[model samples]
Target chain A: MSRIILYTRFNRFWHWTQALLILLLAVTGFEVRGTFRIFGYLRAVNLHHGLSLALMTLVLFAAFWHLTTGEWRQYLPTRVFLKEMAAFYLTGIFRGAPHPVRKERTAKLNPLQRLAYLGFKVLIIPVQFTTGALYFFYPNLNAHAWPAGFLWGVSTLHVLGAFGLLAFLVGHVYLTTTGHTPLANLKAMLVGYEEDA
Target chain B: MTNMTSPSGPIRPPRPGRFIQALAGLMVLFLPVLATQPPPGPAHGAYGRVRAERNRDVTADHTRFKVLQGPFKDGDGSAVTRACLTCHVKAADQVMATRHWNWRPAATDRKGYGKSTHLVNNFCISTLGGNQEACSRCHAGYGMTDRTFDFTKAENVDCLVCHDTTGDYEKVKGGYPNPAVPLAEIAQKVGRTSNQTCGVCHFFGGGADATKHGDLDDTLLKAPRSLDVHLSRDGAAMSCTDCHGARSHEVAGPDYGAPADRREQPRFAGEAVSRMACTACHTATPHASFVLNRHYRKVACQTCHIPAYARGGLASNLSWTWSTAGRLKGGRPYEDKDANGLVTYNTIHGDMVWAKNVKPEYVFYDGSMDFTLLTDPLPATRPVVLNPLHGSYADPDARIWPFKRHDGDQPFDPVQNRLVAPWTAGPKGSGAYWGDYDWDTAIRLGMEKAGLPYSGKFGFVKTSMWWPITHMVAPKEQALACGECHSRQGRLARVKGFYLPGRDRAPGLDFLGWGLVLLTFCATLVHGASRVLASRSRRNP
Candidate 1:
C-alpha cells in the first residue's frame, strides 16, 4: 500500500468549514421553524442568518481557489466507468470483487462521486444559497407586482430546499462509510492523504 | 309693490333683496327671449342659492311662497316643519318611523336580536336605564325625555339635523345632544348631508370621541389616505352616506349585529341597499393569485387587510369597571385619566381601560353575535360573555375573523341573577348614583324602570364583549405574511375545531411522508453494507 496526497490543505479547510456551516444552518433553520427548539425563534433566525453569510463567504473563496488551482475540473462528471462503479457497490462488492476505479492524487473521486458532487456544487448548493438569501433579506424584496401569496411561495420553496440539502447530506455521510475502512476516507479528508484501495 | 298680508300673518320680505334686484335686472335683459326661449332646468348657485329655475317642474321659490313668507317664517323647528310638510306631506311619516327618531331598530335576521335600545353592553349595560337623555346625546332627535316620549308626533321629527347643508348646525351638550341650530336658516339651505352631518353624532358617541366604535373617530375627518382610503379627502373623498345609502329616510346597514354571510345585492334606484358588507364593493375573489383566491373561501378579507385597529392614534375603550365608581378624593367625585387622556376612573362610572394599535384576537365568525341580555341568568363560576361573536369552524358561512375584545366589571343582582343598570345620571330625588351615591336606591329605581327584578344586594362580575374589527386597514405591504398563520403556532393557534396546514400534524400522514425519505436513506446504507458483507462471505467460501 502507498500513501498519496488526496486532498489539498485549502480543500480540507473548505470541506470541514462548509460541512460545519451546513450542519449549523440546518439545526438553526429547523429551530426557527419550530421543528426543534434548542435556541429560541428570534436567536435561531439571527444565527441562521449569520451562518448563511459565513457559508456563502466560504463558497466564494473555495470557488476562487478551485478556479485558480485548476482543481475545478476535478468535479466534472464523466460517463466512463460511472455504470461500473455503481454496479461494484450494488453487486460486484458482494462477490469479493476489487474496486472498479482506482484513486489517485490528481483524480481522487470515482465517476459516481464526481457526478453527485457536481450536482451539489452547481444545482443544490446554489439553490440553497439563493433561497436562503431571499429569506435573510426578505423585508427588502420588492414584491409590488408579486401576488399576495408570493412571499408564502418563496418561504415554501426555501423549506423545500432545506429538505433537499438534508437528503444530500445523508447520502454524502453514507458514501463516506463506503470506503475500504470507514475511517479511511474520513482521515484522508482531515489530514489530506489516502491509501489506494 | 304693495305690502301683502298672508293667511297666517303679514308677509315678510326676502332677507337678501340684492338677489331679487339682480333677478329683476336679468329678467329685463332677457325679456326679448322670454317669449321664444325654452324653460331652464334647476341649477344651484353659490351657497346653495337657486341661481335659476326655469323648469316648471321645480317648486316655486319658497321665499315667494305665502306660507313660508308669513310672520312666523323664522320660528322654531316645529313651526318650520309644519309649513314645509304642507308641501312635503310624506317626509314626516318617513322620518318619524326610522331608528334615528325612534332610537330603536327592528331585527334583520333571527340571530340579530338586539338593538341600541335593548343591547346589554359592557359600555353602559342597557339604554333601558332610567337615564335615556344622557344616552340620547348620540340620538338623532332633539328631546327624548323618557320611554314615554311620543314617536307619532310629526313635530318631534327634526329634519334639519340631517338635511342642514350649512355647517352651522352642531349638537352641543346640555340636557341632551340637541344641535340648537337656527331652524329657518337650516330649512332654507337644506340639501344633501355631508360627512360632517353623520360624524357629529356617530363619531362622538358613547360619551367621548372614538370611545364606542374602534373604526370611526374624529380622525376620519382629516385623515391621511393611509388611515382610511375611502374617507381620505385626498383619495376617494367618500361621505358616510355614500356607503350607508339611504332612501325614504331609512339608512341601509346593520347596526345591532355583524352578518355571518351576505351575498351582494344590487341597489336599485330609490331603494335602500341594506346589505352593508365589504363584499358589496369588492368581490369574493379580489386577488389575482389562485392560492389567494382559495384563501378567500376560509379567511375573511378584514382578517388579512386590517392588521391593526385604532391605527389613527385614537385609542378605543378596551375595558370598563363600574364596581369602583363611588371612590372619591378630597370629598368630591374623583376623576383620573391615563396617559392617553382616557378616563381611567370617574367617581360616577368607575374604571376604564383604553388601548390603541391593538392586535385583534382571531376567531371563526359568521357575522351574528349572541349577547347575554340583562334578564339572562348569570353563571355562578364562569366569566360572562356580554357579547360573544357567534361562529363555528365547521360552519360554511364562517370565516376566520379579527375582533377587538372589550372586557368589563359591572354589577348584577345576586339573588335575582339579572344585570342591573343603576340610575347613574339624574337629580337627587331620582335615586341616581351620580346624584346621591346610593347603590340600593339607584338599583331599585333602575330595575323598576326596566320592569325587571333586582336584589337589593349587588355583586360585581367580570364580563367581556367582542367588537368586530373591520377598519384602519393597513397598506398591502403591512399585511401579515403567510408564515404568520401557516406555522405550528401561528396566529390561528387559538382557533379550534379546524385543520390548518403547517400548524396541524397528522401523525399517520406525516409518518408516511418522512417514511419514504427515511426508507431511501436506510436502503442505500443497508444495500452498501450487505454488498460488502456478501463479498467477504464469497471470499471465505
Candidate 2:
C-alpha cells in the first residue's frame, strides 16, 4: 500500500467549507419551508439568506479555481469502465472482487464518480442557485403583473430542489465508504492524502 | 491570472491577505446602507418632531381677543359659532360640505350611502322618522330637530365642540352647550381639539361611552403609554387633530377614506395626505426584523400592533338583539345589568353583549365597502353583512386588517325582503320604539320618512357590522409575537385565501418527501448491515 496527495490544501478547504455551508443552509431552508423548526421563522429566514450569500461567494471562488487550475476537467464524464464500476458496486463488492478503477495522480476520479459529480455540479447546483435567487427577489417582482401562480410554481421548484439535494447528500455520504477502506475517502478529503492500492 | 508553474503541479492559491482585504472593502461599502436604516422601535421621536414643527402656537390668545371675550349666555353655542364665522368667513362652507355636518354623503355619493339616509347600522338602527331629534344630540349642528333645519346657516355650525380647550364645554341635546356650562369662560379658552373634545361625540357613539368604535373611549383621555402610545403623555402626547390634520374645518380621518393598503413612506409636515393612517407618521416597513418587514406587503400594521380592540377598561358593544326590546317590568321599561355591572339588557335598546380587550376578527380589506342600502333587497344569508368590506387575498392591493365585528338581530321586512329602520326615540305620542314600545309604528314612520317602501309585515333578521380598528396601539414589546399566528390553532386560523408556513402544509408533498427520506435511510441501513456481515464472514472463514 502507498499513500499519495489526493486533494490540495485549497481543494480540501473548499470541500469542507462547502459541506458545512450546505448543511447549515439545509437546516435553515427546511425551517423556512415549514419542515421541523429549529431556529424561529424570522431567524431561519435571516440565517438562510446569510448562508446563501456565503455559499454564492464560495461557489464563485471555487469556479475561478476550477477554471484557472484546470480542475474542472476532472469531472468530465466518460463511458470507459462505467459498466465495470456499476458491476463492482452491485455484486462484486460482497464477493471480494477487484475494483474496476484505481486511485492515480493524473486520473483521480473513476467513470462513475465523474458522471455523479458532473451531474451534481452541472444540473443540481445551477437549478438550486437559479431557483433560490428568484425566490429571494420575488417581492421585488410583485409590482410587475407576472402570470398568476408564478410564485407558487417557483416555490414548489425550490422545495423540490431542496429535497433532491438532501437525497444527494445521503447517497454521497454512503458511497464515500465504498472506497478501499470505509473511512479512507473521508480521511482523504480531510487531510488531503489517500492510502491507495 | 495563469500559473507560471508546470501544469502537473498543484495550483497555488491567491494570497490570503488579498482575499481579506477584498472582504474588508466590501464591508466598508455596505456601511452606508447599514447606517441609513431608521432606528427601530415605534418611531416616536420622528413623528413627534414632525408634529411639533407644524403645530406651532402662532394664534393670538383667545382670552385677550375681545371677539372671544364674551359674556355669552349658557346654552347659546350659536353665538360663539357666529363670532367665529365673523373672522373665518368660509369655515361654515367647509364644515357643511363634510359628512360630519350632513350625517349623510352627498346625494350623488353612491346614491347617498350614509347613516342618516340609506345606510343602517346594528346599533341605534337609524335616525330617520321622529328619532332624528334625539339622535341629533351628537350632530355638529344646533337645533337640527328635523330635515327643516337649515344647512346653509353659518351660526348652526358648532365650532366650539371640536376646538374647545376647556373640558367643561359640553354638547347637550340639539348640539347646544349645557345650560349650566360657563359658555363665556369656555369660549375664551378655546384653542384646539383635545381627546376630551373629540371623545364627547366619538367615544359616546352608538348612544353610550365606548359603544361604537372599540378602539376609542373616555379611557384615552388620560391613557398611559400601554393604552395608546400616540395620545398618552408618557409617549408622543398627541391630540386628535395631530394625525387627523384639521385643515379648513375638514377633519381628515376614516370618514374621508380608508385605504387598506398604502406603500408610501412617512410624510413630513406640509405633505399632509389627509389620511388618519399609521403610515401618516410611521414608515410602511417599520420593523427591525426583515421577516417582519416582509409582512408589511400583506399584513396591516394594525393587525400586529393593535393585537386586540376595546383594550381600555370600558367595554365596547359587541352584540345587540333589538328583537328582545319592549321587555318591561311591571308595565314599566327597565334595564338589566350583568354580573360585571354592565347594562346587558335595556327595554329601549335590547339584549346586548359588551366585551373588553376583545380580540379583533381578521378580514382582507381593499378599502372599498358595500353597504346594504335602504332600498336594496335583503340578502339570503343570515346574519347579513351590513357593510361588507370589499377585498380578498386575490386582490394584490388588499391587506389583512383587524376589525371589531358587532353582531345584531334587528327588524327586517321579510315580505319586502328589505331591512326596516325603526325610529328608536321620541315623545310617547310619536311613532317611536322607545316611547310607544311599538315596532310596527316606528318602522312605518322611519320607512315613510326615508321615502323607502316597507311591507306591513316585519320580522327580525340577524346582521353584522364591521368597524376597522386602527387605534389603541400598544408599545413595541406588546406587539404580537411570531408564534401567535404561525401555529395550527393560531390567531389567523380562520383567515383564509393565503398560505401560512407553519399553519399550512401540503400533506401530499409531506408524505411523498418523508416517504422517500425514510426509504433512503432504510436502504442505507440494510446496505451497510449486509456489507458488515459479508466482511465478518470473510474474516471468520
Candidate 3:
C-alpha cells in the first residue's frame, strides 16, 4: 500500500469548520423548538443567526478554493461501479468484501459517495438556506401578498430538513469506517493523505 | 544654542498644579456664597411629578369686569348663568347638548340607541321616570326633575357643577346644587375642573364611590407613580383634560369608558373629535420587541398593559341584582354589606357584588353594541344582553378587548314584552321604588312618564352590561407576560376568535410526529443489528 495526497489543506479546514457550525445550529435549533433548555429562546435565536452567518462565510471561501484548485471535478459523479458499490455496502461489505472503486486525487469519492455529496449540496442545503433565511426576514415581509399559513408552513419545512440532514450525518460517519481499515478514510480526511486499499 | 535651555537635558513638562491651587483658593472664598443660593427645584423624572401651573389661554377676567358685577347672588343659578352669558353667549347651548347636561346622548357612535338615554342598565334599571332625579344627581345639570323638565331651557344646565374650582359643590337627587357653595365665588373662580372637582360627582356616581367604574375612584387624586404614572402628582402631573382634550365643550375620548375602535383612540390634531385612547400618547408600536409590537394589530393596548383593574385597594361593583332589593327587617327598610364592604342589599337598590385586582373578560368588539332599549323587544328565554360586545375574531376592525362585565337582574314588562322603566328615587310620597316599595305603582308612574305601556305584570330578567377598560394602567414590568396569553391558563385561553400555538394543538399532528421519530430510531437499530449478525455468521462459515 502507498499513501497519496487525497485532501488539500483548505479542503480539510473547510470540512472541520462546517462540521462544527452544523453541530451548533442543530443544538440551538432544537432548543428553539422547546425540546430542551439551554440558552433561552431569545439568546438561542441570536446565536443561531450568528452561526448561520459564519457558515455562509465559510461556504464562500470553500467554493472559491474548489473552483480555483480544480477539485470541484472530484465530486462530479459517474455510473462507473455505481451498482457494485451499492451491492458491496448492502451485503458484501458485511462479509469483508473489497471496495468496488479506488480513491485517488483524481477520483477522491466513489460513484455513490459522489452522488450523495452532490445531491446534498444542490438540494438539501438550498432548502435549508431558503427556509432559514425566510424565517429571519419574515418581519420585513408584509402580510398583503402572502397567505396566512405561510409562516407555519415554512417552520415545518425547516425542521423536517434538519431531520434529513441529521440522518445523512449518521450514514456518512458510518460509511467512513468502511475503508481498508476502520480509521484509514477518517485519517485521510483529517491529515490530507490516503493509503491505497 | 546653549541658551536654548540645554536641549535634550531632562525634558520636564509644565505642571498645572499652581493654576489648580489658585482655583481651589478662589473656590474656598466663594463656597459660602454659593451655598446660600437655593438648590434648583426637582426636575421631572421617573419618580413622579408636580402639577405645572395652569395656562389660561383667554385674556378676559370676569371678576374685574364691569358687565359681570350685577345680580350675581340674586335668583337661582340661571340668574347667575344669565349674567355669565352676557359675555359668553354660546356656552350654555354647547353645555346643554352634551351627555353630561342632558343625562342622555342622541347616538352612541353608529349604534342604534344612546348609552345613557333609553338603554337600561342591569343596575338600578332604567332612569326613565321616577329614577330620573336619583340618576340625574350625577348629571351636569340642575332640575331634570321629571319627563316634564324642559330640555330646551338653557337655565337647567348647571355650568358651575363642572367649572367650579371649589370642589365642595354637590348635586343631590333632585339635581339641586348644594346651597352651601357660594354661587358668586364659584362663578368667579370657575376654571379647568380639577380631578377633585370631577370626582365630586364621578367618583360618587352610581350611589357611592368606586361603585360604577373599577378603574376610577378617589384613590387617583394623589395616586403614586406605580398606581398611575400618567395622572400621579409625583409622575407626569397631567390633568384629566390633558389626555382627554376638550373641543367645543366635548371631551375627547370614550364617554362611558373604552374607545369604540382603535382609530378613536387618537385623533390628528384639529381633526374631527373622537374617543381619546392611550395609544394617542404611547404610539401603537411602543415596544422594542417586534413580536409584542406586531400584536397591536390584533390585541388592544389595555389587555397587555393593564394587568389588573381596581388595583388601588378600591373596590368596584361587579354586579347588582335588583330582584333582591325588596328585602326588609321588621317591616322597615334594611341594608347589608358584602365581604368587600360593597353594598350587598339595600332598601332602594338590590344585591351588589364587587371585586378588586379583577381579571377582565376578553372579547372582540368592533365598537357597535346591540343596546337593549325601551323600544326594542326583549328576549324571553335567553339572557337579555343589555349591551353586548358586537364583533368577533373575524372582524378586521375588531381585536381582543378587556371588559368589566357587570351581570345582574332587572325588571321587564311581561305584557308589553319589553323592558319597563321603574321609578327608583325621590321622597317616599313622590312614588319612587324606594319611597313606596311598590313596583306596580313605581312602574306605572315610570311608564306613564316615559310614554311606554306597562305590562301590569313584570318579572326580573337576567342581564349583562359591559364596560371596556382603558385605565388603571400597571407599570411596564407588571404588564401581562408572554406566557399569560400563550399558555393553557393564559388570559386568552377561552377566546374563540383564532388558533393559538401553545394553548392549542391538533392531536393527530402530535401523534404522527411521535410515530415518525420512533420508526426512524427502530429502523436504525434493527438494520445495524442484522448487519452485525450477518458479519459474524460469514466469519464462522
Candidate 4:
C-alpha cells in the first residue's frame, strides 16, 4: 500500500480550487470567443470575469502559502533526465517505453513537467493577469495620455495570452483523458489523490 | 527492540470522520444559504405588501406629469398614464415628424421607397411576423412586452425612452428638471442626462437584440467605436437633440428646391436662425495639430468628414455615395429624325463645354463670334456672354437665352415667356458645341490655375478663355475663397460629405484600424499553433 503523508491543508485547497477555476474559466472563455455558445455571451462573460477574479485571488493566496511553507521548491526545474524525459514523450511513448522520471513526495513533477509548469506559473499567468487587468481598468486610465502604440500593443499581448491559455486548456483536457482510466486523472483532481504506480 | 515492541501499537485517537462529516453537514445546511441569500426586506412585518405600496408611490408620482387612462395600470391597479409626454408634449410632436418616428412599418403602398417598406413587425403587430419582444423595446414604447398587461392604448413611444433617469421611470421624477435651463433650450426640460439618455436604448440587452443589426453580440458591443465603425459612442451616450438640435413640429420638408407651398419650415425657428446645430460644433478646424502647425488653410473639415448613410435594403449596411456630372456631346445617342429643309447632317461633335450662352441684350462684353464681328452689335440679336465671365450684364445685350431667363435680371417671368435661355428654342439646330462639364475636375483645375492651394489632384485641363477672363475681372478674392461655399457648414458640405464624425486623423481611419486588428489576430493564430505543437510533443513524451 502507498503511504500517506502530511500534504498540508492549504496546499490541497489551493490546488483543487485553482484547477476548478481554470476549468470554469476555459469553458466560459471559449464561449465568449464564439466557439460554442453554450451559455449566452453575457452569461459567459460574467462567468469568465468571475472565475478570472477568483483565480487571481487563489493565485495570491497560493503564492503566500508556497512562500511561507517553502513548498515553492516543488516547481524548481532540474536538468537531470530532462532530455530523456523529452525523448520518452516524443518517440519512446509510441514504443511503450518506461517513463524516464518519477514523481515522489519531495519532487512531484518530472523535469519537463516542472519546466512547463514553471513557465505557466511565472511567465504566462503573469502576462495574462497584467494584460487582462489593464483591459479591465482601461476606462480609469482615461486621464493618462497613452503612448502612441500603447493600446494596440497591450491588446495584442492580451489576445496572445488568450491563445496561450486556450492551448493549455486543450492539452490539459487531452492529458486528463489519457490517464489509465478515461476518468482517472479527472478523479485525482477532484479528490486530490491518485493510485500508486 | 524486542522489549520495546508490544503486541499493540502505541495508543492513538480515533479518526475524526464523524466530526468532519458533521461540520460539513452544518456548512452545507447553513453557510451557503447565509452567504447567498439577499438582504431581507424593510423592518415592516407587512413586507409582502410593500410591493403594492411601491406601485402606489410610482402612480402618485407619475400623476404629477399627466393623467392616466386605458387598460394600462401600475402594479397597484392605478390607471397607466403618459408620464413623459406631459413634460415634452411640444417636443414630442417634433420628434414624431422626424425619421425616428418613421422607423416603423411602411404603409402598403410605399413599396418604391426602398427599405422604408421593410417594416419591423415584432411587437403588437406580431401577426405580421415582426412581433419579437427584443425588437419592440427599441422600436416601440416601454411595457409593450409585459404579457400580463395590455398596452393597446399606449403610444408607440414612452417618455422614459429618452429620459431614462431611474431605470424605473416612475420613482425618480424629481431627479430631472432642475434650474440650469439654457437661454435657448434646444431640448425639453430635462436634467443632465446626455449620453446616458441615448444609451438606455442603444446599449446591449434591455430590449434590443444586437443580432438584428448584424451578427453582433455583447462582446462586440464591448469593443470601442474606433474598432467597430457602425457604432457611435456619442449615439450611445447623448440625447437625440444634443446633435439634432431643436424639436421642430415640421419635418425636414422636401428637397431644397421643392415647390414653395409644399415646402416644410424648420420645426424650431431658433434652429433655423443659427448654423450652430451640427456645423458649429463640428468646426472647420478638426485636427488641432494640423490647424496649429501646418498652416494648411485649404483643407476643410468636410473634406475628410464624409457621412456614411445607411444603405437601402434589409441587410442595410452603411455606405457613402458620391455623384459627378460628365458632359457627353452626342446628346445621349439620340437620332433627330426631324430637321429643317437644310438637311443639317447630325455630326456628333461635343466637347465638355462649361460656357453658358450670353444673351445679346446683356453684353457687358461681346466675346461670341457673331457679337464681336458685327459692325453694329444688333440690340435685338445682341447676345451678352453667359459664359460666367460676364459678371453682371444688361438685359438688352443678352440673347433670347432661356438659361438666363430664370437667372439675374431676366428673373424667370413665366407669364411673359415660359422658354428660358440656353433652351429658348427647345433643342434647336445650333452648331454651337454645348454640353455639361465634368464639374468636379473643371472646378479643381479652375481653382489651381487661379493660384488656389488645394490638396486634391485636378484631372481636367482648363482651356476656356473664360477661365482667365473670369479670374481677372470677377470678384477674385470672394470667388477664390471656396471655403465660403465648401466649408464644413456650407451647403456643399451637406451635398458632398453628408456625414462627418468630427475631423480626426484621416477619412479612412476605420479601414486602417480594422486592417491592423486583422494582422495582429493572424499573428496570434500562428503563435498559438506553434505553442500547441510544442506542448503536444512535451505531453506525448
Candidate 5:
C-alpha cells in the first residue's frame, strides 16, 4: 500500500462546500415546487435563491482555479480500462477481484467518472441555471408575442433536471464505498490523501 | 333664465365686529406677557381645543367667506346653486359633463352602453318606463322627473348633495333637496367629499343600505382597521376623495374604458394620469417574497387582499326574484323578515336573499363589459349575464378579478325575445305594478312609455349582474396564503388553462422518477451486502 496527496486544500474545501450547497438547494427547491413543506413556502423560496447564488459563485471560482492550475485535465475521458472498470463493479468486486484502474498522481478520475462529471457540468447544471434564470425574470418577459404558457414549460424542465441531479447524487455517493476499503474514499476526501494498493 | 333668481333671497351685508377687533388689539399688546407664560395645562382645556382645531387641511373656512353667509329662502335648490354660480362661473358646466350628471360615459361607439339609455341591470330592472319619477331621486340634478328635464340649465345642479359636511342633508323625490334640510346651513358648511357624502347614494343603491355593491356600505362611515386599511380611523384614516381625486369634476374610479391590468409603476412626482388604481400607489412587485410578487401579472391585488366582503354587520342583497311579487295577506300587501331581520319577501320587491361576509366569485375581466340592451336578443339559456365582462385566460390585458354576482329572475318578453321594463311605481290606478298589482297592465303601459313592442305575455328569466369588488381591503396579515391557491382543492383550482405545481401533477412522470430512485437504492444495497460478505469470507480463510 502507498499513500499520496490526491487532493489539495482548496480542492477539498470546494468539494465539501459544493456537496453541502447541492443538498440544501435540492431540499429548498423541492419544497418550492410543492413536493414538501418543511421550510414553508416563502422561506423555501428565499433559501433556494440564496443557495443557488452560493453554488454559482463557487462553481465560477472552481472553474477559474481549474483553468489556471491545469487540474481540469484530470477529468479527461480515456478508453483505457473503461470496460474493465465497468466489469469490476458489475461482478468482479463481489468475488474479491482486483480493480482494473489505479489512482495516479496525474489522473484521479476513471473513464466513467470523467464521462458522468462531464454530463453533469454540460447538461444538468446548464439546464438548471437557464430555467431558473428564466423563472426569475418572468415578470419582465411581457412581450406581446410571447406565449402565455412559457413559464410553465420552463418550470417543468427545471423540475425534471432536479430529478436527474438527485439520481446522480445517489449513485455518486454509493460509488464512494467501492474504494480499497469501504470508508477509504471518504477518509481520503476528508484528509486530502489517498491510500491505494 | 327666468329660474336664475336667487332663492336664498339676497346676500345680506355684514356688520363690523368692533368688540372682536378691540379684543384682538388688546391681546396683541399683551403678547409678550402671554409668550412668557408656560404651556397650557390640561385644566386649561379651551386653549388646547382651539389649537387642535387650527391644525386642519382646509385652506379657507366657508363660514368666514362673505358670499356664503345668508338668510336663505327655500323654494328650490336652484336658488342655492345660483348663489354658488356667482363666484364659481365654470363649476356648474364642469359638473354637467360628468357621469354623475348623465348616468352614462362620454360618447363611445359601443351601442347600448349607458345607464340612462338602453343599459339595464337585474336589480330594479330599468328606469325607461314610467319608473323614472321614483328613480330620479338619485340623479345629481333637480326636477329630472322625466328625460325632458333640460340639461343646459346650470341652476338645476345641486352642489350641496356631494359637498355637504352636515350628514343631515337629504334628497327627496324629483332629485330636489328635502325642504326640511336647512339648505342654507348645509351650503355654508360645504367641504371636500367624505365617506358619508359618497355613501349617501352609493351605499343605498338597489333600495336600502348594503343592497347593491357589497364592498360599499354604512359600515365604512367610521370603519375599524380590521375592515379597511385605508378608510379605517385606526389605520390610514383616509377620506374617499384622497384616492378618487376630482380633476375638472371627473372623479377617478375604475374607468370602464381602460384595461383592468395596469402595468405601470407607482405614480411619479408630477404624472399626468391620476388613476384610482392600486398600482397608482403600489408597485406591481409590492410583496417581500419574489414568488408572491410574480403573481401580480396574472392575478389582481384585490383577489388576495380582499379575502371576503360585505363584512361588518350589514348583509348584502344576494338575489331577487320578481316573479314572487304581488303576494298579499289578509287582502293587504305584507312583508316577511328573516332570522337576521333582513327582508326576505316584500310585496313590492318580491323574494330576496341577503348574505354577509360573502366570498367573491373569481373571473377574468379586461375592464370593458358587453351590455344586453332592449334591442338585443335574449339567450335561450337562463341565468344570462346582463353585463358580461369581456376577458379570457389568453388575453394579456386581463387579470383574474373578484366579483359579487347578484342573481335575479326579472320580467321578459318571450315574443320579442327581449327584456321588458315594467312601471313598478306611480300614482294609484295609473297601471303601475305597485299601484294596481297587475303585471299585464304594468307591462302594457310600461312598454308604451319605453317605445318597445311587448307580447302582452311576460315571464321571469333568470339573470346575473357582476359587480367588481375593489374596496374593503383587509390588513396585510389577512391576505390569502400561497397554499390557498397552491393546494389540490384550493382557490385557483377552478381557474383553468394553466398547470399549477402542487394542485396538478403528471402520474407518469412521478411514477418513473420514484421508480428510478427505488432501483438505485436496491442496487446499492445489493452491491454493499455482497462486498461485505466477500470481505468476511476472505478474513476467515
Candidate 6:
C-alpha cells in the first residue's frame, strides 16, 4: 500500500468536531421548532447556543488553519467529471457501477465531492452562520442601521440554509448506508479509519 | 464498435449492496449520535403537555357546550339533537351563561321595550334553525337530537363541554362512565383547557353569529391588524376562564355590592360584574378612560345603571332609581323641623346628573349636547322637618333630574354645585337649552377637536351620545377611545381601515416580512452560484 498521508490529526479533529456540532445543531433546531421534546426546551436551547458558539469558534480556527496552510485549495471546484459524478450518484451507483473519480493521497476528494463540500462550506454554512449571528445580535444592532427589509431577508436566508442542511443530511444518511458494508462508513467516522482500495 | 470491443471493458456500475450497506451504517451512527445526546427535558415536556392538555380540554368543552345543544337539522329534513350531554353533564351552568343559551327564536313581538320586542336573534338560529346538522356541527352542545330532548331544560349543554379530560380522566378514574363520583373528584380529574378551546369557538364561521353585536367573521378575525388581540387559528387560544375567572360563582347581585362574607360570598365573583370582566383580559390599566385620565376613576358602571337583584328570577333590564327615606339605626325615621311651621326631614333621594365631575383637561364632551332624561328616577317626593323635636314641618320636592355637567373644579365652579350654566349666549325664549341634544353635531365637533377620525355611524341619536359616553368612561382615551370599541362594526362596513380611537398605531410588519424573503432568496442564490463556480474552477485547475 502506498502510505501517502491524506488527513492530518487536526484535520480529522476539525471534521469530527464540525460534524458533531452540526448534528447537535440539527437536534436543537428541531427541538426549538417543537417537533419532539428530547431534551427539555430550556436545556436544549442552552446546549444549542453553546454548541453554536463552539461551532463558530471551530469554523474560525479551521478557516485560519486552511488559510495558513494553503489547504483551502482542497475545496476549489472543477467542472471536469462533475456531470459523470452526478450521474454516478443518481443512477450508476444503484447499478453497481464504478466511481468516475477516485480519491488519492494528494487528491483526497473527487471533483464532485469537492464541489459539494465547497458549496456546503462556503455557501450553506456561511449563510446559516451569518444569519444566525445577525438574528442573535439583532437587538444590539441599530434598528435603523440595516434596512428593515434586509433583516427580514437575512432571516429567510437563514431558514433556507436550514432547509438546505436538512436536505444534505437526508442524502448524507442515505449515502452512508451505501458504503462497502452497512457499518463500514459508520466505523470509519468513529474509529478514524477506512478500507484502503 | 470494434475499438470499444478492443481495449477497455464496459463501464462498471456502483455496487448497490455496498451503497445500501453504507446508508445503513450512516443511520446506525446517526442513531447513537442521537442517543448519546441528551433528550430535551422537563420544561419542554411541561410546555408540550400543557399545550396538549389545554387543547383537549377546550375541544371537549366546546363540542359539549356550543356544538351539540342544537336542534340540528339533518340532510333528510329532520331535526336531530346529538347526545353530547350523555358523556358530559357538568357544563350546564357554563352553557347557560354563554350567548349560546339564548340562540333560539328571536322574540318577534315588538311591543315590550321601545326597540324590537325580541331578545337579540342569533344569526345561526335565524338562518339555520335548530334542525340543521351543518349548522349544529359548529354550534355544539347538549340536546342536539330533535325528538329525544327538551329545549327548556337546555339538557344538551352539559359540563365538560369545553374541558378536555382524556388523560386526566383516565388517570383519576378508571374510565369516563363513572357516575358515582364526588364533585371534587370530577374537578380534580379535569385539567386546564388550552387557547385551542377558545379558537374552536372563536374560529371562522363558528362564533360568527352575525346577528349579534360582537359577531366577527374569519376574514375580519384573521386580518393583519387584528393579530395582537384576535384569536389565532394555530397559535395560542385563550380560555373562558382567562377572561371570566376574575370573579367566581359565590358573588351575588349585579350591583357590585360588598360581599356578605368571604366564606359565604366572595367579592369579584361572577354574576355579571363588568369591572371584573374588564380586569380579567386587561392588565396594566384596567379602566379604559380612567387609565388615561385618572379623574373619573371613582365612578363605576354599576353606580349609574341601577342593578336589579334576581336570585331565582328571570332576566331584567336596568333602570334608574333614587332612595327616598333615611332609616335610623333601628330602621326608624329621623326628622327635623323649622320654626316657620315648616318641616324638613332626612331624604336620601338626589338629582340625576348625566355627567359626573371629572377633570377639565380630560373631559371629551362638547358643551351643546341635550341632557333630556330617558326614564325618570323612582321616589318623587318626601316630607321633611328642620327640627323633629320642635314639630315644625316643611314640604320638599325630591324629583330626580337628569342634567348634564361640564368638567370643572369640584365644589369650586359655581356651575358645579348648581344644575344650570351661569352663562348663556343664546337668545331669550329660544328653548335652545331645553331642546333635545344634537348628538351628531356634538360628536363631529368633539372628534374633530380631539384629532380623531369621525367615520363611525351616528345611526341614531341615542347611540351618538351613548358611544361618546362609553368612550369617555374608558380610563385611557388614547388607548381605549370611543372609536376603538365601535370600530369593530365600522371596519366590517369598510369604514376607516380598523382604526381604534385611542391606541398608538401599530407598526405594520408585512413589508418587513416580504423584504426578509427577498433578501434570503438573493443570499441563497449567491451562495449556490459561488459554490458552482468554485467547483468548476477546481475541476479545470
TM-score of each: 0.65, 0.87, 0.76, 0.33, 0.83, 0.31
Query: For each candidate, what is the lDDT?
Result: 0.69, 0.78, 0.70, 0.36, 0.78, 0.36
Pick the winner on lDDT between candidates 1 and 5: 5
- For residues B194-311, could you state the per-residue lDDT of candidate 2 as single tens digits? 7788789889989999999999999998888888888887777777777676656666655423787644333564664554667645766666666678787778889999988888
DockQ, Cα level, model 6: 0.03
Better of 1 and 5 by DockQ: 5
Candidate 3 Cα misplacement greater than 4 A, ranges = A1-197, B1-76, B104-112, B255-275, B329-351, B379-381, B426-431, B436-441, B522-541
RMSD of 2: 5.0
Each predicted complex: what DockQ? 0.08, 0.35, 0.10, 0.03, 0.17, 0.03
Give the clash count for model 4. Answer: 38
Give lDDT tens digits, candidate 1, residues B212-324: 77877888888776777666654455667656778788875555666745655676764557545667766667654434555656688778777777888888888888888
Clashing pairs in 2: none
**lDDT of candidate 2 at residue A116, scale 0 to 100:** 87
The positional error of residue B218 in candidate 5, measured at the CA in angstroms, is 1.5
Candidate 2's C-alpha runs over 4 A off are A143-148, B1-59, B64-72, B86-90, B106-111, B261-275, B283-294, B328-347, B427-431, B482-490, B500-503
Model 3, residue B304: distance off in Å is 1.9
lDDT of 4 by residue, B1-541 (tens): 1222333533222223543563344234323222332443322323225434644565234323323322233321112214445554565555554443443212342222211122111111111111222234453243333222233333444444454444333211211221232211212233333334544443322123221222222322333332222223311222234333433532231111111112123456444422222224434333333221121122222122212111111121111011112233455522222233221112221211111111111112222221111111212221222223221122122111111111111111122221111111002232111122332333333223223333343221111111111100111111122232223343233222111111111334434444554555564455445545655777886
Q: Please report, as a residue range, the 10-residue window in candidate 4 chain B with the lowest summed lDDT.
A: B467-476
Per-residue alpha-carbon lDDT of model 6 for B365-439, expressed as tens digits? Answer: 221122211121212112111001110001011111111111111000111111111111112232211121232
Better TM-score candidate (2, 4): 2
Pairs that collide in candidate 5 are B7-B79
